[model samples]
Target: MLRIKLKWFHSLRLQLFVLFFLVSAIPFMFFASLTTGRIEAYFLEDSKAEWMRQANLVVSQIIQTNNYLKEGTNYTIFTNKIRELSQSEEVNARIIVVDPLGYVVADSSRIDLNTTLLNTQIFNALNKKNSSERYEKAGNFIMSTAVSIIDKEDNDKVLGAVLLSASINDIYKLLEDMESQIYFLSLIASLVIGLLSFFSSSIITRPIKTLMKVVQRVTNGQLDQKVKLNGKGEMAELANAFNHMTEQLQLVDQSRQEFVSDVSHELKTPLSSIKVLTESLMCEEDVPVEMYKEFFYDINSEVDRLNVIITDLLLLVKLDRTEIMLNINETNIKHLIANILKRLSPLARKKDIEMIYEANKEIYAEVDEVKLTLAISNIIENGIKYTPEGGQVKVKLQSDMQDVFIEVEDTGIGIAKEEQGRIFERFYRTDKTRSRDTGGTGLGLSITYRTIIMHTGSIQVESEEGIGSTFVIQIPIKHV
Candidate 1:
């Protein structure tokens, strides 16, 4: 269970869910805080204003009654009026009337009378100024507004002050309710966002999971496993690329199996022949000298054939190495082809085939002469071996500023289009029986292809079923 929880914590889906939840919830919390603060500010300011208005109304009534005039001063009538105003539902508060000396003349609650009330709002009122203040008193929030009563006869003379103090506990309660609602809404939104993130993460990781499973199967030698492609995006492209890689792996596996089979068959055939010949000589009590010589000769030929196959296989292994070094040199390509043709001239002549060489100009290129010679020799030899009697084989060389081109055309049995693609594969033969009869090991073209690729060059074949074939080779003039 702990392991499962750890895995979930580390998963992309969980990470995305957390990211989305915080992205939405954090801002919602900030907005809720800001809204609550503003509401509190607005409510406090409006309540204070209303209380100030009430204080001003009391000041106006005191002025009209001439209560502040020494001869007309009536504390009893003024106290009654203050009490009457304070009892009204809209003015539900403690109302205090203070003389200019800051002594409370009357209180609506009837508690602060005759007491010296000294506060910032009371002081400001004594100076003919109206002011309001908010503070905590007796564990309750209180808002107090104080207004000055001015003498009608002398505009600057301050009569007294009316101070109204209201409890704001209901406002706080309302704000607390609003905060609860905001928290509830935020939680709901976070859950919705978390669910959305989980699904989105699933959509993204589904293809990756499929790819992982396919890779595991491939590691277990299931090269045929493939990912099923879905919608178009980077994930789709990744699946397509993985499928292509698996296909190549499957082909390589098949080719490897075929290579083993072919090598075994090729080696076994000569060994079997040599075994039969030796067995015959041993089984016979008396053998003629001529018969002995023929048997020995046959055994020697088989041995040489076996040697050839081994040598070719070893060379292929060397070429397949990633760090195989080439003995690169600037060589006269025309001379090289000429030498190959000269060496193979006898074989062409035996079949009564005409060999021709064409060159537009003398071409020089950076190449591994020994390897390149073997590559070109194999193609030319195949041409001579496969062509009908009296047919022609032609070798052409040409060059441009940066590359050299060699074209070898043979009037031989051509290859089919479908089989051309696999001709360069190891141990692949268009006609297996004909290839064996021609003494072709089927590694020639594969070796040639790898050699050219090492030189950063390219080779292609154009052939028809009944017509002739053309092989084109292109190599860079300078090695990079």
Candidate 2:
């Protein structure tokens, strides 16, 4: 049980429950206590006032009886009046009539007769002041009120004093009963609040529980799992973000599968061609020298194609690392473009494609010369390969204060708009037949894209089908 309770303490629902209960219950208890105290004080003050009024009435009656007696103190009449007043239901009190010397003349209780009583209330009455007091005696709460009795002949003269004392134990009992009821109601309210807190906590944690379940499913490789949260709150926003992340993961997984399939197909094609060529050579006995040379040359061409594909794949893997090694140098941008054009000029001449190089100014920028050259060479080479005879492949180099831009435009078979977005993806080709015939490995642009990205650069393609394509490269002037 202890362990279970400890575990529950870690739960968000339990924490919220405790928080809500305390937040609500504490203030309610405090105010209840304060209100109870106020009620007790109000009752006490009201009782004291009523008792004083009754005592004053008795004093008036005593003065009237003395004036009727014409001269002496009529102890019998005073005693009967005091006894009658004490037995009355409205003022069920202990009545005592004291003389001017503080000697009790008449006592309703029939005890303490002719005794000197000099309590605070009785003493105040003798000095012509009305007063009331409360105290505890014999385990009973008591309230005593005293008022002065004056002579009718001389109002200033003190005739005697009448003291009314009552047992207010019933008032305290009534207050105790009220306090019990209040406490019972408070207990009921606390129970209701606790129940509310429990359910409220459950409502709050429902979304979090759903999120946890989705996350668990996702961890188990179920990338399609999505959290269905309602309302536009943080939780809903989180759900949207999580769903988007899963979508991206799905796309990456699909892309990876495609890459593997393409790699297998690419490798298989060259190996199959070499196998067929070697088999033809082996089966043909005493074949012509020209035919034997032709088979070997075809075999050599397939092997070279395989080597290019493998080399590009290795380069891509290297570029994909979290940290790519770069031999950063401030190289001439114009000179680099010229060198790439010069190298690919032979391929261009074979197809009668004109290679053009234009530079606005001699710009220099920080770059890894070997990698950048390879990337740019691939683009220019592709332009030369795809362009028709007598077509133009134009290379331009220019720079701003912070960045250098390279543009390669070619009058080649332009890519379709829909396929342009994926041109930089590995093993993705716009025209697979054309790419195969042209000895394209389909990794050139992918390598170029990654290499440029490693240098914090961007490349964009602008193309229209049947027209031509323009490739724009932008790299920062400085490497940070």
- Write down the lDDT that model 2 would get: 0.86
lDDT of 1 at 362: 78
Candidate 1: tens digits of C-alpha lDDT, residues 1-480: 111222333387877888898898898888888888888899888878887887787777767765543454676787787788788886878889887889888899988888999788899988977888889978888888998878788887887788998888888889889888987888898889888988888877666666776777778788889899788988889889988998998888888999999999999999999999999999998899999999999999999989988988998999999899999999999999999999999999999999999986778899999999999999899999989999999999988899999999999999999999999988888998987788878889999999999999999999997778999999999987
TM-score of each: 0.69, 0.65
- What RMSD does each model have against the real structure? 6.3, 7.7
Per residue, candidate 2 scores C-alpha lDDT tens digits across 356-398 of 7889788989999999999999999999888999999999888
Error of 1 at 177 (Å): 1.7
How does residue 367 of candidate 1 score in lDDT? 96
lDDT: worst 10-residue window of model 2: 1-10
